[model samples]
Target: MKIGELSRTTGVSIRSLRYYEQQGLITSVRQPNGYREYTLLTIETVETVKLYLNLGLTTEQIASFLTCVLQNKEAFCTEVMPVYRKKLAEIERQIVELNQIKANLIDRIAFLGQQEQGNDE
Candidate 1:
């Protein structure tokens, strides 16, 4: 398929698909007419790239995993798992920080409520 067809099949914009190619997260072959030709496997590859991006992985990180996968190596166990664990830890820390912020907001709200009640009295 051509680039347009691959974009439609993957539901990713043509610009993003081209960016993915530039980032080495995806690949395409150039036709004699200067058109980009994609294999059927490009659809699945694009989907995987989308998934990795949605999971907060950078293009470089996704590229590493994709390279390993293309080489028939154990991407998950060797390349991807460590990065996944690091991301998970970062998310956990963010959750804790957000919880603390929420607690502070709740306390401030309660104190303001008390002050307003005192003023009313």
Candidate 2:
């Protein structure tokens, strides 16, 4: 379909889609009129790119992973495995830090509650 249709369908802006193409994360064909045409598979790839982006993966990492997926198709143990594992570990570490902050907030709230009750008494 056209770029606008793809953008509307994927909820990604045309600028971002073009950026994806420029980043080599997606493939498109140029029509005779200079308009770009996209395939359904491209939409799927864009969704995958969005997922990685949401996880804070860099453009380089996402491009490499997408390339790996495109080349090996059947090879599951390629470079993407190690890359994704490392990313997952980093995410886990961040989650731990976030949880610590949440716990600290809870403790502070309880302490403030106690102080307010004391003041009231």
Best by TM-score: 1
Clashes of each: 0, 0
Query: Stretches of candidate 2 above 4 Å error?
Result: 30-34, 39-41, 54-56, 74-77
Query: TM-score for every candidate vs. truth?
Result: 0.85, 0.77
Which stretches in model 1 have alpha-carbon errors above 4 Å? 70-76
Candidate 2: pairs in clash: none
> What digit string (tens of lDDT, one per residue) describes model 1 on residues 26-115?
778899999999998888789888888999988888887786765574544488888899899999999999999999999999999999
Backbone-clash count (model 2): 0
